[model samples]
Target: MATLIVTLSRLNARRHATAPVAQGSQCRTETIPMPASGDLVANGEEIVELLADADCWVAIGADPDSSLATDGTGTARKLKADVPYTFGIQDGEKVAVEAA
Candidate 1:
């Protein structure tokens, strides 16, 4: 199993009085264990950042399945160990992480 440090943030961007205004909410961070069954990391998040202790796979809005062979072959994206990766997610979308 691979462990991931996941952070979810919501960015509020708008035009206020003809001026561009951008604000970010407090980030929610979690240490998730990625099992063969995969782990759900984000739900309806505006952005997600992930750092894994081991190589893993992530699928936005879908399951990552159980292994690397199946991951990315579908909807999953691969994440290298000890590297930080960020993703922009659509509203109401879900993200799942699985061990590689």
Candidate 2:
């Protein structure tokens, strides 16, 4: 199976903060497993039913003081950020699935 490196970035950072993927994104020295896409649909056709804003569950909880909050919680305390995931598809099926 293929592999992917998912990363996150704090959009509310006062200074320039991003991940390596684009900018301040994070890239581990090792390859990690693919995370749950939060996609519970059995098929793509049913995606039409999950049009609600909360239908797609993204991030939750908080960022904590060790996270971006180290600088200042201001807005980071609310776990505000962006999730940019990477993956591949072969023959219309999602490839590079990681083991649970």
Candidate 3:
């Protein structure tokens, strides 16, 4: 069986706040900087590394403070904000957003 490392960042329910990732006996927390991407910014390269060995699930809650750009226009300024976005990753599957 593979291991899954879940890290919490500003993208979680609490803006700029993070939670601990506790699994079995391992306990560690790190403050991740929001990314240049959209709302769920922290779900970046590091998260991908964690799920590399297993089918993974990212359980992010909604974030109201997100300054997401309007639609595909990308008109809104890329505000320095954080939001929550969750996704599941299966090994060998293309890692990207899926249609709702």
Candidate 4:
């Protein structure tokens, strides 16, 4: 099975609460922030497209306090070394960005 991990570029406060509902059982709930309009990424293709087009790239596992920009303007962050991930590329895939 394929697992998808989503992270928001912006920072928001989230809350997790747990309370006892019955004599022994407990209830737990978490509140997360929702992305604004046109900011939701559905699949890998969409994420790839967004990264390809983004002038500013901010990933979850990037360098601390660093910004990566497509243009020759900003410093891009790097993914941390602890997390493991896999990237797939298929034939007939086109590269959209060009060298400056």
Per-candidate TM-scores read: 0.65, 0.19, 0.19, 0.18
The 0-to-1 C-alpha lDDT of every candidate, in the order given, reads 0.65, 0.24, 0.27, 0.25
Least well predicted 10-residue stretch by lDDT in candidate 2: 46-55
Residues 31-53 of candidate 4: C-alpha lDDT, one tens digit per residue: 11211112232222211212222
State the number of backbone clashes in model 3.
0
Candidate 2, residue 77: how far the Cα is off, in Å: 28
Which structure among the candidates has the greatest TM-score?
A: 1
**Once all C-alphas are superposed, what RMSD does model 2 give against the true structure?**
16.5
lDDT of 2 by residue, 22-45 (tens): 224322122223333322212221
lDDT for 100 in candidate 3 is 12
Best by lDDT: 1
The residue-level lDDT of candidate 3 at 53 comes to: 31
Clashing pairs in model 1?
none
Q: Among all windows of ten consecutive residues in candidate 3, which has the lowest summed lDDT? A: 91-100
> What lDDT tens digits, residue by residue, belong to model 3 across residues 1-30?
322333322212334446422223322233
TM-score of 1: 0.65
Q: List candidate 4 stretches off by more than 4 Å.
A: 1-4, 9-72, 81-100
Error of 4 at 78 (Å): 0.2
List the candidate 1 regions with Cα displacement exceeding 4 Å: 12-25, 36-44, 62-73
